[model samples]
Target: MLAKFLPGARGAVLPLAILLLVVIMVVPIPAALLDIFFVTNIAISLAVLMVALNARKPLDFSAFPTVLLFTTLFRLGLNVASTRIVLVHGHEGEAAAGHVIEAFGNFLIGGDYVVGIFVFAILMIINLIVVTKGAGRVSEVSARFTLDALPGKQMAIDADLNAGLLTPDEAKARRVEVTTEADFYGSMDGSSKFVKGDAVAAMLILAANVIGGLILGPVSHGLTIAEAARAYILLAIGDALVAQLPALMLSIAAAAIVTRVSSDKDLAGQIGSQFGSPRTWTPVAGILTLLGVMPGMPHLLLLSGAAVAGFAAWKLHQIERRPPPPAPVAAVEPADQSRIGYEDVSDGMLVRLDIGYGLVPLVDERKGAPLMGRITGVRRQLSKELGFVVPQVRVVDDINLAPYTYRLVVGGVVVGEDQVSPDEMLALDTGQAVGSLRGKTAKDPTFGLDATWIAPGDADAATGAGFLVVDPGTVVATHLNHALGQNAADLLGPDEVQALLDGLKERNPQVVASLTPQPLALTTLTQILRGLLAEGISLREFRRIASAISIAAQKSPHAEDIVELIRPDLGSLIVQKLCGVREPLRVMTLEGQLEGLLGQAARADTSGRHVIEPDLGRRIVDAITRAAQPLIAEAKPFALVVQPAIRIAIRKLVKTCLPDTPVLSFFEVPEDKAVEVVAVIGASQPAQAGHFQPQALPA
Candidate 1:
């Protein structure tokens, strides 16, 4: 039984037994001698514990030197004053001398009190910083342990779901639910630890003050200890509480502010309900202070403070154990026509778009407007090039979908779609009866017919297409800036204006069908430009020739050709302008030119040709071409490549002409049958043209 209670019992029992004996001796020491004994015991015990903890799990102690220094100063001051006062003045002396000596003694004891108070204050500060900054780190650790336990908990909810966990929506929901709950509990635990630690430290200091004063003050005949312990305790408690009150109040105030800002009713209600309870602690503290003011109630204050600390600790623990609330349900549209109204018929609102053969209400009475009329005008313009009626429409307020993609629906069911921006939507070939629409209508009560339209294919055919309706107001605002070079309000009349609504609706089909690839091409070009700039190309050089480069590269040249054309210009410019050098630099002039020359030669003739041959020339060119293809594909209209010397000059000229395309370089090598053409990309030295030295490639 002993062995079970204490692992490695034989090894540990001797030290623990010795510790108990020392603690017993130290605890019984008289108040006058207690300071040295207690301090020594504490210092020794702490050192031992620290060493053991370090052996098991080392700690980073760099953060605590300030605390250590403060404690050391207080200890030194106390010891010096105590030694001076006790040695110089005995129990008997002139009345004035006695009083002066005692005053000096009080200063010494005051130093000890200050040390305790400072230590507690430092601890509380550290705890607060950790809780705020390291909460995420704590949560990550907690999640690792808790996530493994999730499956067991989920199994208890449903047995069948356990076997097919992947397919079970409940299982996936439970995973997220468990993770969220774990995070909340972890955060609460950190807060609780900080609060409990502070409260306990405060209680300890109060106890020390009251008990120490009662026992020690009288022994020195109202001379030595005085009321130093009690006074110090009260001061520490008052200062600590006052100092921390702002932070505590701020935390609670922040929670309240968050509740007010949120549109979520449940969150607001929960915050409002919790606010009343924790808020009461403030007033309770005031009442305690009033009680402390009464004569002969110092002991009572101490006891009450201890009790409050204990209760706070318990409450914090309870909060850590409390279960999280249920997850929110997904929003669903109403099925009944009665639920539809002008108030509900706003632009930018999310709505389910259906394209089934079944009859759909042409006129929704709630909005006092006809849906068919609004869509007809948009569809007519789209049909001007390709004739057809659009089958369905769905409206939404926001467009924060995933990159390079848009959602597509057909007959109330999602079909095929591409991930691209609205501009890129125009380049894609959307099949028959498929297109996108955008615009506001008379039926839209909010923000009216000021919305952008995105469709697939020509607007002429609507019969087979599907619609994803978005807020007409937002769409008009988006498209009006593009089409009319002004805001939606400036381009269209009020929401109720039928002609304006009709015009927007007519434009919707054309807008929907305009989901072409042109926008994606532009976006791709932009990304390439950004990447080159990030690689340290100058903004002035980038802007000067980016457009021409893009136009030149659109023809899709072979990778080798692209590199040959761009590299020399870009590399030379980067070396000269950025690296601060100027000259027509040949391969022989470079410091690390040999490795590059060898690498190119080896790559051209992988069969380990000892000498450069005619075939190597072709191989080198082919390799270079292959490397340039991807760079060209990624370059934007404004992308520029800068290099050193010759390459830099070449790049500058290329940039002027092909501002929108990638620029490359060219260098000649001897032709040989054994060697295949090879390309070197990035910032590397040019291969030696006359190299024929036999050398093995590095492993």
Candidate 2:
């Protein structure tokens, strides 16, 4: 009930404390009140020192900079209040300022003003020259390095996000922490200047109080020169000592904070553990004992110190020789082999590579496995190219498989399986080889080209004969890469699409905010993006894609409709990727009769269900396959240019048989580029340059 009445009390502390500091500077404080304030100043400085010693890392005390500013202001206020009381009240007595100041002046200096002045000057020098200056320099360097490293740290977070090592929320939290660290270091750099200024002010205030007291006391109170000097100088010395001691302590605290390195233990623990070794203490003990026995030394004190060090060294040696405690054993429980649960039949990994038991050495680091490195490289390269992180490939050994076999599994189904000799290299024949190799003949596991398994030492010989040779590890990795490329659409889901939108928000926030939930849901956008990836397109330019989706969403919510509307905008990007910047696009053009036939088939398939007669579909598939063979044999890239309405239908017809070949609509080809008709699909041979013409499709 009482807590309910304290409305806004907790929020008013900072403003009220600042107001009190101002009051102390303007108001003339009595001796009793000055004593209370001086004690408070000392307590705060000590508390700050203890906190700094206990901190594990600099960020653990992120509020130190602000605390430093307030504490310095508090000390300066005390100095002003004390100086006024010391000069005006010096003629009365030595205890005029307060007992706190009088005791420091009398007991510490023993009535000698000269010694007090020397001590105050030394404290000011240590604080201003050594501690404060070093801390300020450290803060400046730390701030500069942190700002310079910000971009690289951000890129590291992006890389980890793409690699599936960090979730979205984790990545966001790390970014926030990085930004806060930069702000903290930069603030500390500027705040350190305040402490340095306070040290300078203390010295000037001490001198002013003493000089003003000597001149005023004899003239105003009718006292003798010696009497006035003794009274005023003592009071001035007391005032300076009371204020400078706390100022020095605060400076040391600040230095401790900026110089401290990050560690798991506090300062005391770190020092104690590092020096606890028997080897370290034993040498010190010997040195101390040797010095203690010297004839001219003080034997009592020196020998006592040596005895303590020797005892510490003996204890440390005993600790180092102690054996660890034995482990406790537990009773074994019997197995229940017949029990079954849902976990026993859970889904398999999204992408898994299972190898035979004989090939286990390919993944073992001790045996120099190159397969794991190759797989990591493939994932890294593909992640950059495809604009998303690929999940880790789970590689394991299967005893049921053949000794030389490996399988690539996706969604619990094996998509590709092959056999390779674990100790041999595969030499592929690209149809221009001149010499023969003595080895077992086979086809390349990735592309099904004619290849032979040969000895590793015969690699140079095979290369000299126009054969491409690769090790067994390369063979498995290439097969895995090709399989993943074919099914990249399957890896993309709502999570990946959301990541792409978040990245876009960094550059264009308005588009992502308006398009995602307000106009189009994530599921619809993911389907469209997956469709593009399935057709062998990169989503790196997702900012443009999002803008296109925002415009298309006003008319239709269908993924297929949206994709068709955006295809023209992305046409140049797609074409440039397939054909390099220098070469004209080589294409296999459909004959006039064949183009008309596909148009009729597309009209009959208005539902986009690919409805066509079996005979007609087979003829078209056979013709495209025949035309693509020559290009494949010569290692030249080509796309089949067709009418816009029939592109999707023909893609469906040939996707399963010729997965690597691209089918493009006329709009996808850039107008600035020239087209070369490499072959005619329905013709018997290559088309002549004068006989071939690419016909435009009817809208």
Candidate 3:
């Protein structure tokens, strides 16, 4: 009860007293001056009140009497200065030099009064700064206030609910609890609370001033006891209390308006949105202008302006608080109701219906499903109208036929469709699965070669005869047929052969270099050829032996021999074409022997024989030249064809030797005919190089 009336009542009382004083001021000269005095007094009082309220600590009054006495002295000094200036100079002209000097002296004597008023104004500005900076602090203060008061408010609400002050639903509705935004102004620093407390403090200050003046006015200023007492009471009431009332009212009104506006959720959001706009600050400017223009009672104008600004802000918030219309309710349907399936629709079928979000899956299903011929016809018709391709049809069932059951999958999960309509199942045309199987058939060398050389088949059944497993050297020799255009023996001399033998011996000397008992270093043999060519050996010999070694490596059962024989000569170009020889530089070592041979041959005569060791050199050169003839002849037409064949044969031979180990084939044969083609080529080629290119055969 006290909180409700105190603020408003205090607001009204001061204004009324000021009005009475204004009336009295019109009666005489001294009274008119009283108006100015009252205004300054009020301004000072309000400033002090604001400072006290905004301060971090509570006001201390232990020395209040001394402060009051000092304030009295200050006011008296100011009054003397004013009187001297007015009396000595008069309104129209400058006073005598002596009189002006005396007035200046009086002004100096009254300096304390002027300083006090300036100090009060400075305090008010400080208060404003504190409120602005400590916005969070203000909120904390408000929260504390609310918490202290909540229990009583909650109890009141509970009592109302129990007393049937509301219906069951209304009681359950619960009071709309206030949040920080609702309780505090957007300032967030608790400025509203500070303002409220300042207004109350202003009223108390006014009351104190009135009482103090009445008691002390006679002693300080020259006046009769009764007149002094009357003047003091009037000064206190009119200047302090009366002038401050409007400011208090404005502060309370502003706080209430802000609270109400913020209580509306939509309004609060609008305030946030509009806060950045230029229009939001217009009210603040207007209020400040009013405060500046208004004289003695400026606090009234300032407070009124604040109140109006708050009200205007509330109005702005209201504009954004329009009620939204309720959403239209959807009609419920029975669970057993039949719905058309997407698959049942013809290819060209046009569908239009009101459906829920759940129905989208069915539409997607229809788009993916295969369509039958009848459905295809429908699709064509629809396509003509829609100017788009209709879904193709693949299968259809007449009414008398048994229903075809198909699985429906959504997101990879399969579902069963029972009694599905023809329209539900779309027909689709997919290409023939068999036509896609076209490929080259590889030869099965195991079927024709001697069983003793071939590893036994996985099942050991007497299903067919076993064939010999081609050596890596033999496979290489066969492929060399195209590159060398001659027998492998003719291209490889005793020296070249001896070099390969030495490299193979390094790994395992026990193994012999033959088609059946493939050397352990067949891979090294190929590597040596590759190296020789890289070292400037004429490709004539290297090409033949490398190709042959590749073929042999493909079929060699011995994995190590396959690797060593091919490792040397797998130079850049050949390695790239073969696909698996990754290191071109590493393969370069294989050509070392070939390079030595060329050096030996370059020094030889037209017969291609070296000068030194004429017989042995002659034999080596002749063998190489003869072996190179077939490869050189066929290279232009069959280079691509033969190299890969050699590589394939080598891969197969390697697989046969290491029956328990895995061998990766370099040939990229088609999936269907891979085994058949490999077998045919391996069997057709002889284990000896001279068989295919007889001219290059060793004598």
CA lDDT, every prediction? 0.36, 0.85, 0.36
Candidate with more favorable, higher TM-score: 1 or 3: 1
Ranking by TM-score: 2, 1, 3
lDDT tens per residue, model 3, 507-538:
54544334212442534554444333322233
Q: Give lDDT tens digits, candidate 2, residues 107-203.
A: 9989888898888888888889988999899989998998899899999998887766776778999999888888888898998898899988887
Give the top-scoring candidate (lDDT): 2
TM-score per prediction, in order, is 0.22, 0.84, 0.20
State each candidate's clash count.
120, 0, 103
- Which of 2 and 3 is ahead in lDDT? 2
| Residue clash pairs of candidate 2 | none
Off by over 4 Å in 1: 1-71, 94-657, 668-699
